[model samples]
Target: MSCQPQYKGQVYIWLKNKQTCLLCGETTDTPQPICTPCESELPWLGDQCGRCALPLPMADLLCGQCATRPPAYERVLAPWAYDFPIDSLITRFKHQAKWPLGRLLGQLLALSLQHHFDEGLERPDALVPVPLTTRRLRQRGFNQASLLARWLGTVLQIPCAENLLRRVQDTPAQQVLDARARRQNLRQAFAMMADAPVRNRHLALVDDVLTTGATAQALARLLLDAGAARVDVYCLARTPKPGEPA
Candidate 1:
């Protein structure tokens, strides 16, 4: 019986990992979709800010913003620059409730973070999703960040603290705001869950995309204030500075 279960488990994983490319509809028998050619053409991030993962002209450099005013989190890690198909995928996954697309992105993110951990990246004690407001939650019927965090936690063997934080205020959607406005809009927008036991534990915040980073700074500051040893941010893609070519 034990051997039969093991065999079935292997078959399940094999079938789950093999799928056609989600983008091009090409047949693929690999662990993740998008296929080799489609993935190679994806806007992988190049040189970036050591802190925010914002694409920069050079490596080993911090963007002027991070230099002038350091963010509360330790750093941001992302594999792709938000552009073209990535943005489209995130839009469909988040706004259209496309679970398969979300799964693909989450798996790719898990692989990237796993590679970093193998190379000595400090593993976090828990993964937290940037919580959605109650109203937004009702409208969306799902939290993309929470889903991504759970997927990453499962693949990385890390625990996910999906309820560690909650949105206290339903501030306007930040997609329309400038960086300065985003900061102001998110002030006191989030609060830690009561008795979350965050003291001295490292945590990483997971999200679909990281843009102005106002949301991350606010959440990281909350965790740090609650005595977290460290905080990091993870996202599938990081946006280039506004008006800059990707």
Candidate 2:
């Protein structure tokens, strides 16, 4: 039950108060950096698979893949599809170390999550970020998932278990792999720490995006096997099926 904190500073406070739209360079009056029009025009996820959050043609329907074989996680909640501007924004934040962009996305995600919470979606007892391998951590200097989980935990008032999970193997990046290959790549990749919090409590996994969902499936399976009562996923966006329209 450890707390993950938010950044505090005059600059952070200023950003939290009011800001300009990052997408169009327009001055916005709201606390969120993105203005209303840009926010509305973002590639929002409309109908999606209830289990995996795969963009779907209709609401309240499971995608064929989920119907055939449901994932280990209970469900996924994402505000947008990983398309054009969202994809680009995430890329910049992840690769370029753009802290403000990351915080903007995190704040928007927190609002989406709060709406769900108000509508009676069960909140988890803790948030656990999908971990990065030591090699990758050294290479990147940060784990984006850990940062997202910390921001979400701070905004949502939940404890974040940052070290509860560990990546034991430095597997190939999932982005370049297809679904089946991604599953194979993640085999025996993650481990739980000695003081891991995984028993009988509802937990949520936070990450940047849900691509093939292989990483989420593996982590959720691990948590469930370790006696977690329930597990859910919260991510900024969900990538649609390959060759599908945005």
Candidate 3:
């Protein structure tokens, strides 16, 4: 179990009190909720395929690929696209060590959840974040997805389970790889822990971003194989196929 630090202070209280972009570290005298320029720059998901969450032509509700090969996870809910300031925000948060920025992203994710509920979506029984490799955890000092999951749980009134899945293998980063490569890289990388307290639960697997649905599919496969009844993905952002027509 991860040790909880003495309740020092609320994270949002700290960020909202300061006048800098929690994501990009840019200073703003009055950041518009989350830096106006930053929020505007965030890639919004519009007309995305319901199955995989990839952007689709307005005429077509389902992308051709998803229609051909549906993913294991039932559905994906992505509020934003992975581009521009959102890209910069995620890059900084994950790579440059901007940990506090996750709270800002979490707020957006919470709002998205409310919107989802309003649209008659069923809430998950538990929030389970995509597991990080132990190697990465030691290097980064935190898991952004886990932090987001905690916030998501608080907002949705669902419990967050941090250790339902374990990253058994330290796979290569997905960004530098192609679709097939990404799938292969994550194969057997994750496993449902036998000792995990989650079983037969409707789970929402949270991640910072969703690109090809590869990671989520892989993790979902493990969960189902281990007896999870259903797994849905909840991501902060989804990346459109590079250079694809909007």
Candidate 4:
């Protein structure tokens, strides 16, 4: 008699053997849903600013913006550039409620961060997700940043604090605003939890993507003012400057 196993479901098969890629649908050897080839081609951020993770000609060099007017966060760690498949995946996961994509992306981000930790990256005392306003939270049904931070915390063994920061203002969408406008829109937007113990603690702000970084700057400044010794920005992807290729 033939001894080939017959699986009851795709989940069982995936658990037993090969895992399917989330993007190209091809089978991948790695535990991640993305295959190695797809991952290699996924617009990984290269030669970025050490402080802001902005793509530049050299790695670890401060970008013009940071050199002139530095942001509140000490550093930024991003694994991918906001382009192509990564952008599409983030949009689907955030706007369309496609949670599977979020999970996959979170896994990938955790792996990258783990590598950073292995290479001597300083781990934060806590992971703080950029909070959404009550109105936006109600509309979206979930906070993508919080969800991603939860997954990352689970993998990295760091504490995730969803309530560390609260959104006090229901600001307009930032996508339509310029840098100055974005900064203005976020003024007094975030407040620290009165009971949270953040004084002199190193905290990392977690988010889905980094665009102009106006949001991060605002939140980091708030954390600093609240007595955080250091604030680092952590995001899955970083978008290029305006007029630059993604």
TM-score of each: 0.93, 0.92, 0.84, 0.93
Better-scoring candidate (lDDT), 2 or 4: 4
**lDDT for 156 (candidate 2):** 95
- Quantify all predictions' global Cα lDDT against the true fold: 0.93, 0.91, 0.82, 0.92
RMSD of 3: 6.1
* lDDT, residue 158, model 1: 99
Q: Identify the superior model by TM-score, candidate 3 or candidate 4.
A: 4
Each model's Cα RMSD: 3.3, 6.0, 6.1, 4.7
Quality of model 2 by C-alpha lDDT = 0.91
Best by lDDT: 1
Question: Is 2 or 3 the stronger prediction by TM-score?
Answer: 2
List where candidate 4 sits over 4 angstroms from the true fold. Answer: 1-17
Task: Evaluate residue 81 in candidate 3 and report its C-alpha lDDT on the 0 to 100 scale.
Answer: 79
Q: Which ten residues in a row have the lowest lDDT in candidate 4?
A: 7-16
Model 2 regions lying over 4 Å from their true place: 1-17
Model 1 residue 172 CA deviation in Å: 0.6
For model 4, residues 20-93, the per-residue Cα lDDT tens digits are 89889999879888889998899999999888999998766999999999999999999999999999999999
lDDT of 3 by residue, 72-151 (tens): 78889988878766777787888787766667788777887899899999889889999898889999888888888998
Residue 163 of model 4 has an lDDT of 74
